[model samples]
Target: MLNVFTPNRHANNVLEIKPEELKERNIKGIITDLDNTLVAWDEPDAPEEIIEWFRKMGEAGIEIVIASNNNENRVKLFSEPLDKSFIHSARKPLALAFQKARKGMGLKKEEIIVVGDQLLTDVLGGNLAGYYTVLVTPIVETDGFWTRINRKIENLIKKRLKRKGKI
Candidate 1:
């Protein structure tokens, strides 16, 4: 059961995931979480560094889609300026959104990776959908109320995963 929450890879942030590395792994698409994973939850736009990262990914022919549980308005405001595809209010940890992302990307499971900061939502959803998952440390220490609750459960799970050397 714990395996569902385990990510195939972990990184400090999305930028740490290099385009070359993803290319080498044959990962053609990315279904990434917007809040916390890409930027602080309160941030309204992508930072300069994140913009450049997206440019690099595009230069490498990698498609990216924002799959966020956030409201449509929030997701649209953040993603539009970047010209990235997106799915808002994606109730992740459920297979529906993950399947939609895969189908939308027109890529096979192995050709894409799910990247996010949450274990319960992103990692579990990705794994359950049969795609590789990458867990990134949240960009900010602060989180919204619901996320704070999820973080508490994640901490307990992390401790157990650590005890078993699975993290």
Candidate 2:
């Protein structure tokens, strides 16, 4: 199942993607991870580039919701518009959060894209929830004890996926 890890498809942290590309692909919403996928975990505020990207994506009519393992405080502080709802205290690698995020967007599984940096949590959870998954590179390498363990496991999956030529 970890064959879902696609390293080459990871977008730049600056969001090099054009909104039109996602629109043409029929993706109505994006469920993104908070820590590394959206911003550097240690960074206290969202960068100007990220703010612009979110604004552009919103202007293009795409719904974006954050599905983060971080606590509600962190997620709320991160996505300050308070306009879009998010799944905080999310226990990833579980389908519940993905389900909640998709339901929050009022979008079908097929119309949503789950973007994150981890294979086990992000890709696997997104796939299990029946949404398209986009695995991105970590925004910053340093992590907590638990996250370090998860990253190790994700690295193993990534190597196996590469051997299988799935990435």
Candidate 3:
């Protein structure tokens, strides 16, 4: 059960995941959480560094889709300007949205990875959907009310995973 929350890899942020490394692993598609994963949850747009990272991924022929539980308006406002594909109100930890994103990307499960900052949602959802998952440290210290609750639960789970040397 705990294995569902475990990520295949962990990084400090999205930028830490290099395009070359992904290319080597044959990862052709990326389904990522928008809030706190790519940018701070409150941030409205992608910063220059994140733009550069996206450019690099594009150069490597990697397709990316933003899969967020956030509202459609918020997701659209953040993703449209960047010309990125997106699935809003994704309801992570559920298979439907993940499946939709994967199918939209036209990539097989083995060729894609799901990246996000939360274990309860992103990691578990990705793993359950049969894709590789990458857990990134939250970019900001503060989280929204619900996310705060999830974080507390995640900390407990993390402690257990650490005790078993699974993290």
For each candidate, how many residue pairs have backbone atoms clashing (under 3 Å)? 0, 0, 0
Candidate 3 lDDT by residue in tens digits, 58-101: 99999999999999999999999999999999999899999999
Off by over 4 Å in 1: none
Tell me the TM-score of each prediction against the true structure: 0.98, 0.91, 0.98
Candidates 2 and 3 compared by lDDT, better number: 3
Query: Residues 61-144, candidate 2, lDDT per residue (tens digit)?
Result: 989988889888888888876466788988987889988888888888878888888887887777777777787778899875
Between which residue pairs do clashes occur in model 3?
none
For model 3, the superposed segments whose C-alpha errors exceed 4 Å read none
Q: Mind giving the per-residue lDDT tens digits that candidate 1 earns over 1-167?
A: 88998999999999999999999999999999999999999999999999999999999999999999999999999999999999999999898888888899899999999999999899999999998999999999999888999999999999999998998
Full-model lDDT for every candidate: 0.94, 0.79, 0.94
Q: Where in model 2 is the C-alpha error above 4 Å? A: 4-8
Cα-lDDT of candidate 3: 0.94
Model 2 per-residue lDDT at 24 = 97
Worst 10 residues of 3 by lDDT: 14-23
Compared with the true structure, model 1 gives a TM-score of 0.98
